[model samples]
Target: MKDTVLNILVDLTGSDEVKKDLDVNLFETGLLDSMGTVQLLLELESECGVDAPVSEFERSEWDTPNKIIAKVEAMTNEL
Candidate 1:
């Protein structure tokens, strides 16, 4: 799950070095913007099977790769 989220973030940011910083704030670093967030959510749904709604996506909760993985894992566990 971490790998999947990392891959999505890397693809969106076009930065291979992002993997080294798992807890980096993507938004603050300008690595992810509103448009990229939407694209990432779509990829997460299609590839990871974690269909989190856009309404529930909060920057504080899903900002980093680790946080995103935790969010998705929680969502999936609820199903």
Candidate 2:
């Protein structure tokens, strides 16, 4: 799951370093933006089958890879 999430982040951000730093602030560091987050959510749904709705995405909840993985795992379990 971590590898998948890391891969997704790398692909979306075009940054290899993101895979190494799971806790980095993607937005604050300029690695991601609002539009990127939306694209990421869509990618998560399509690639991982984690359908996180845009309405429920809090920046704090989905900021880093660890948090995103937790969210996706929780959502996947609920499915």
Candidate 3:
């Protein structure tokens, strides 16, 4: 599951560092922005069956690889 999420991040941001630095702030580094985040949510929905609405998304909650994975895990549990 983590690998799936990581691959999506890498694909969306084109950042290999996302895999190495789990705590890095993706938005701050410009690796991810609102558009990319939306795409990420779409990917998560399709790939992981975790559908999170964009309105409920907070940058802080989805700012890093680890945080994104945690958020997805939380959402997946809701399904």
Candidate 4:
């Protein structure tokens, strides 16, 4: 899951700077902006088969690869 999210981030940002050990804040890293965030959530929802509300979109949820995995896992569990 982490690898998958990492791949997505890399593809979106055109950067290989994401590391498994590094704490990455997508916004701070400039890997994601407001528009990118929407696109990412949509992709995640499609890929994970989960619906994420825009209101649930939070910076903490997208802070790092691990957090992304956690968010998806939680959303999947809810379904």
Specify the highest-TM-score model's number. 3
Model 3 over residues 35-56: C-alpha lDDT tens digits?
Answer: 9988998898899998689887
Q: What's the CA error at residue 73 for candidate 2, in Å?
A: 0.8
| Tens-digit lDDT string for candidate 2 (3-78) | 7878989988999878788898888888889988998998888889887887989998878887888888888889
lDDT score of residue 23 within candidate 4: 69
Clashes of each: 0, 0, 0, 0
Clashes of 1: 0
- The candidate scoring highest on lDDT is 3
Better TM-score candidate (1, 4): 1
Give the per-residue lDDT of model 1 (tens digit) for 22-75. Answer: 888889988899999999989989988888788988888888878888888887
**Deviating ranges (above 4 Å) for candidate 3:** none
- Between candidates 1 and 2, which one is better according to TM-score? 2
Stretches of model 4 off by over 4 angstroms after superposition? 19-22
Q: In model 2, which residue pairs have backbone atoms overlapping below 3 Å?
A: none
Q: For candidate 4, which ten residues in a row score worst on lDDT?
A: 17-26
**Where does candidate 2 stray beyond 4 Å?**
none
- The alpha-carbon lDDT assigned to residue 16 of candidate 2 equals 88
TM-score of each: 0.91, 0.92, 0.95, 0.80
User: Residue 21 deviation, candidate 2, in Å?
Assistant: 1.0
Q: Model 3 Cα displacement at 59 (Å)?
A: 0.9
Q: Can you give the lDDT of residue 54 in candidate 2? A: 78
